[model samples]
Target: MLDLNSSDDSSKRNSLKDPISLNVGGEIYTTTLDTLTRCRDSMLGAMFTGQIPTLRDNCGNIFIDRDGKVFRYILNYLRSGFLDLPDCFSELTLLRREADFFQIRPLLEEIRRYETSVPLGLRGGPLGAILIVKVDSKVRVLHFNLRHGPENYELRTCSVRAFTVDLFCTWRAFLALLCERFSYKTTQGLTSPNPCHPRQNRLKLEWVPRPDELPQEQYDKQNYRGLTVSSPEATWSDDIVNMQCSPCEITDMQGFVEELLKISLAEGFKVDLVTPDPTEILTCTSLRLVKS
Candidate 1:
């Protein structure tokens, strides 16, 4: 909606500038805002939309950092244009994500740099060696276990792989936890008569942060973190088995999908929220629909 011939046209360097008031964690910051917010918002939104919340890593403590907090950092940045982040805060993925979404380019770069530069301790379970995924590649996948533990990252060379995807996608942990708990396997690449076939698999993962809720306390002795999975045996009805597998992972594929995946897929394509009509736009790769 811009008039190319307006005063804030290509001729003016600062004409498109606008002052923005931001409430970052509690403090206030007024800065010259850029149009990149729109682009950043859309990009970040697409990357995280429809994610399973519990599956997200809880580095909640990082928001406050070890010594400096978000509000402190924001205030410092606003007053003197300095980013005084603690070692902890700088390593957080979510903060980096937020920074990118807000078009804080320097902050984004700092976060990425901090991840490789900061030295971390030998904590975090799945215990040792965790992948610092830059992008998805064979090195990241085959060497996953070695990459998992938090590291004392003094200074590391980050190849372009850091930008692509990770060694393994986040979904791997979800799959592992699911299979370990459910005693089930995946149906990754089977073709259907309809190549654009849809698959919707939902399972409830029940966990207790403390020990007592678990039936067995042995895992507690090692501080297995009181983690245990309830049986998926009863969660799926006879129908779900049909879709996930020829017999559903728990039931049969067609029948299982028709009941759950198909219904959910159909619901996603429903364009008319007030009415029952919706444009059934199938995801080109898969016959998937997401109404919202």
Candidate 2:
């Protein structure tokens, strides 16, 4: 087990490091992603915790650690290969630390899923084939969208994001989206895209900027009008609003996980849909994986 002493002393826990690597899905995959890093250590000291975040595989299967403290499972074991139990997914705040340590995309994503204020600021930007809502927090690549109301009566697409508000992370760089029909989730995720309109719309990801925090000068206009400009990406529609977001070449995020963990998941992994419960739709990040 990793040499970690849990004392009531908050300072000790704050300065703690792990002696293990965190593995998921019963298989441990530690490639570019690790379980400990400087970034992860800092996130552990936050006062309040964010909402529970979950991830879905390409098979449309949602996977969340019991109690929803998935980050601990990833961060604590990033180094020594020991994932201490009891404080697993139940500890929500620790999860953010783990994601930063391992550089896991999905984990990073879930962290940014809880931020309501456009802290870093976001506006409309090129989201690959469609325009995406961008967030300039920790990882410059954080972004999402929400559209729901009894006004429409179709489906509500609402979500909360949480991420680092101060990390210089990698962006999609040069990526394109490939549009595809989501045969799955027709009955889920913001009311699902109309089957007939398979190509209704999608915002993959392109060169979305994590803009610098706007100063009082920029906000003057909105501020003058008493409008709170939450995010920089929310300013106005430039050429990006005209851009289109397509599907990515990668079919599913599960494929990538399989190769990372080196374990073959069962043919099908599924969960029953819960009604009245707002459907959480995460863009499954399963990409085709290759053995290293």
Instruction: State TM-scores per candidate.
Output: 0.24, 0.18
- The local distance difference test score of model 1 is 0.29
The number of the candidate with the highest TM-score is 1
Cα lDDT tens digits for candidate 1, 102-157: 44544555544554564433111121222211111121111112223487323322
Instruction: Please give, for residues 47-105, the per-residue lDDT of candidate 2 as tens digits.
Output: 10111222434432223233233543554444444434441122223443445444444
Candidate 2: regions farther than 4 A off: 1-16, 29-35, 38-189, 193-292
Question: What lDDT does the true structure give each of the candidates?
Answer: 0.29, 0.27
**Candidate 1 segments whose C-alpha is farther than 4 A from its true place:** 1-21, 24-82, 87-91, 122-292
